[model samples]
Target: MEKRNQKRLDKKMLSHYQLQLLDDEDKRSVFLIKLTPLNSLLFFTFFMILITTLIFLGLKYSPLKEYFTSPTVENQAAYKNQLLKLNERILELENNLEANELYIKSIQAVVSGNIKAEKVDSLVVNKFHLNPDSELFKPSEEDSLFRIQIEKEEMEAMKASKNTVPDAKYFTPVKGFVTGKFDLTEKHLAVDISAGEGDVIKSIADGDVLFSNWTPDAGYTLIIRHANDIISMYKHCAKVYKKQGDMVKKGEAIAQVGNTGELTTGPHLHFELWVQGKAVDPEEYIDF
Candidate 1:
């Protein structure tokens, strides 16, 4: 066991640390160092994290951050909720749309003269295909409420009212000279067309005879209501051809010119036209 102050160093290996045995323990040598590569990697990772944090803070304070982040996570979450609500609303609207479509179809059929208008009224009254408790009608509107039976009667009457409309050709009621015009202030709702005494009075257009009667103001009156919202009246007639309900055509002799009615000045024909509860100028179309 040769030992000189413990161990000896080799001078040839100057670049490396030389360990010499101390006493009788040459196998036990020590070197003090903690310079592992892991420490370097740990430091580098730490530095990188700091840099990333700085960048995040900078971006958060920047004005352009709002533009980019607004449509991102938070915004996307809100948009998702909104989209769900919108989908629910759309489903509800689709259901209502289907019901409305059927209602419109029914109304169209009625308007086309296929189904009567009264049928529609009944459908509404009975809530046949509607929510009875819906907000579409308030309880206060009960005054306007009509039963299906009454509605049926109203509908029947309305259907009968179809007879009220007169044809377009029946717009003119006389073929004579206009001696007077319709004046509301004068209380004259008709025109006095002076025809030759005993001149043949023709039916202005096609219509069903409503009456062939005498009135105090209108001596011999013949009222005809035709289709298409038209009506004609002839007064001061000495004679009448067709009676009530007789379908007369235009130019058909219906009466003879005569001096009648308190307002009539001579043996002229008092002709008039009515439309929708109002009277207009008859000379607008008739050549005479």
Candidate 2:
């Protein structure tokens, strides 16, 4: 029997090695592979790079990417929370818009006369649903007397006020011949006073300017709210010297006469006097 022997590896073997595949019949080399320390290291590096590239491409483009990118419970909950907040915000905006629309509608109703202004006073009275005949609301004898006395005083004051204005107290707004008079049949509620162009128009009484703006039919117009529930309207002016909310005294120059409105035939002032919301004859109040 022959004994087998094993070879020892040293520095020379670690440095370089070779492998060969030979033909069994002639012992001729069919394939040859050479290996070295540096060559082995370069091959291992390239192999690792290829493997890593394959793994990276699979994760980036394949369905297996969902394992890392798909939403978990916490992520889904966060997204749902954001959606709920957005929904709540939208609902809040909708509510605010509805409230604003209702408010605008109420104002339009009042302005268009669909809701009577006097009915608003009734709302205040009806709020508590208390009957006027209730004992708690009944007036005593002294209260009745006091109310009567107050009413008498108010009547006397009104009478005195009427006389005070009739005695040349109201300043004439313009000095001009009347081309148009207050005629209810013609629906001419305002008095048309014809004057030269650029004539300074004055206020008839001490008041605050309620409106000073241009209208298509009335042109440059100014309206003043005076004491004792009196309102004066002056229309078809060339220029307005005062703006809305200005304070003016009697005979103060507020505008210039002009034929600027669509309703005007020539340079004139369309003057209107209203007392307690009713148009009255300006001739009765002013001597113009």
Candidate 3:
């Protein structure tokens, strides 16, 4: 009897426990399952491990990994590097802009005759230096040829102008008193002569009438082209007797003086002389 009782106890200890679902009032089992404690513990542990593994995989392989991991040091460093490069580019652009502004100001000063050509040449040579290996900035053979041709032309022009004499026998355009003189600083390139109304204005030299027209500023205007690149302009005329392309002698009647244009305050003639595309004092070449 003692041996049999020990065998039964051992079997009971090894048997699985009953798990049941029942109605509370009827006390009837609707579903049932049996599991040993060791098996149940093993199943719960495996299920928990599986759930943890799935969560880890989801975070690792998905966009949620950013939230789980620390921020990337490489990305931060790359962004900083890009910002630094942009700053450097900005600085370079600013430097280029400053250099360009200085160059433009120097050019303007040169054009206005405020600075000497020698000074401007020296400034250009000192300010701008071309890199030896830069293809775009280097001067080409064609450029050198063009520069040489320009220098040759300038030399030829200078030689032609060197021994030229001023015209001492230029005809008087009108008998009048000079009221306004040529002043380059004032931008008045012509001399204004006050004359009687309907006073005859004559051509200053033998030339072809280049322009004969009326303007709002100088009502009846005329321009004559003469030899040696000399040009004469007569403005504020009451009447013009010549037309464009008409040939006239040195003392031919070409116009009459009057306050005809909006710029004239009274009967006057505004006379201008141009030599080689530069405005000169008309009094220097013509007797009023």
Candidate 4:
């Protein structure tokens, strides 16, 4: 009986209710509403949802967004500084590489008789404050005596200057008739010798092979650096037996005659001689 009574009370609390308003003087009903527990619950849920949507939109589209989502000014500046340092490091590496390339080219120029080695020496000396006109370059009494002795010896042999032709004998590179002569005005700095195919080509003097490589205009080219600042070049060869830095004696076989380059017409050897950074007629110094 008690359980039944409690059930009846709960049902009555959950049941519908009526709300009304009446005109006080006219004594007439003006409005009325019937409300239920389910309707009240639905209204409360809708109000909560509307409040949540408003908060989300304010966060997404208002100035408050940056406060939560964007990086701080200090962090952005630090990143920019890191990028600048990286750029500076890359620039320094590029400059170093360029300097190294220039150094290598300068050495090659001296070896190939395109520039005097003394010029390089002078440049280095000047950089270190040891130029000829500097006080540090003044010779002492012993140094003066040594210079006098060396000059006297050179004078007696009729070889006072460094440019005097070396006493070393030159060997003919190939037995052939001249097809082209060295001409400075024509810019043909080498002589073309017409030889039979596969004829042996020899080194003219004792030297180390400075370069042996293929090029479009002078294929199978070989360059040698000899004593007394002299250089020899052989181009348009059928084959080469020596490589860079290999030493070859005078008359040693180094290559074979052939038409191997785009500049060639028939089987031949193109030979050039350079002394003291100047190209000279090979026939003047070598008997072909």
Candidate 2: segments with Cα more than 4 A from true spot: 1-168
For model 4 the local lDDT of residue 208 reads 89
Q: Give the TM-score (vs. native) of candidate 1.
A: 0.41
Score each candidate by Cα lDDT.
0.64, 0.77, 0.77, 0.78
Model 4: how far residue 219 lies from native, Å: 0.5
Residue 282, candidate 3: how far off, in angstroms?
0.9
Which candidate wins on lDDT? 4
Q: Report the C-alpha displacement of residue 280, candidate 2, in angstroms.
A: 0.4
Off by over 4 Å in 3: 1-164
Instruction: Show the colliding residue pairs in model 2.
Output: none
Query: Which is the leading candidate under TM-score?
Result: 4
List TM-score per model, in order. 0.41, 0.45, 0.44, 0.46
lDDT by residue (tens digit), candidate 4, 105-183: 5445543446544333211111133458878879999999999999677444422223348565689999999999976
Off-target runs (Cα >4 Å) in candidate 4 are 1-168
Which ten contiguous residues of candidate 1 have the minimum total lDDT? 118-127
lDDT of 4 at 80: 99
Taking the tens digit of each residue's C-alpha lDDT, what string does model 3 give over 1-288? 999999887777677899999989999999999987667878999999999999999998999998888768997898899999999999999989887467445433433346643332222323567687888767789998999999788545533442234545678899989999976546677899989999999998899876787767778888787888677888889999999779999999999998877877999998877665556677767665
Error of 1 at 166 (Å): 14
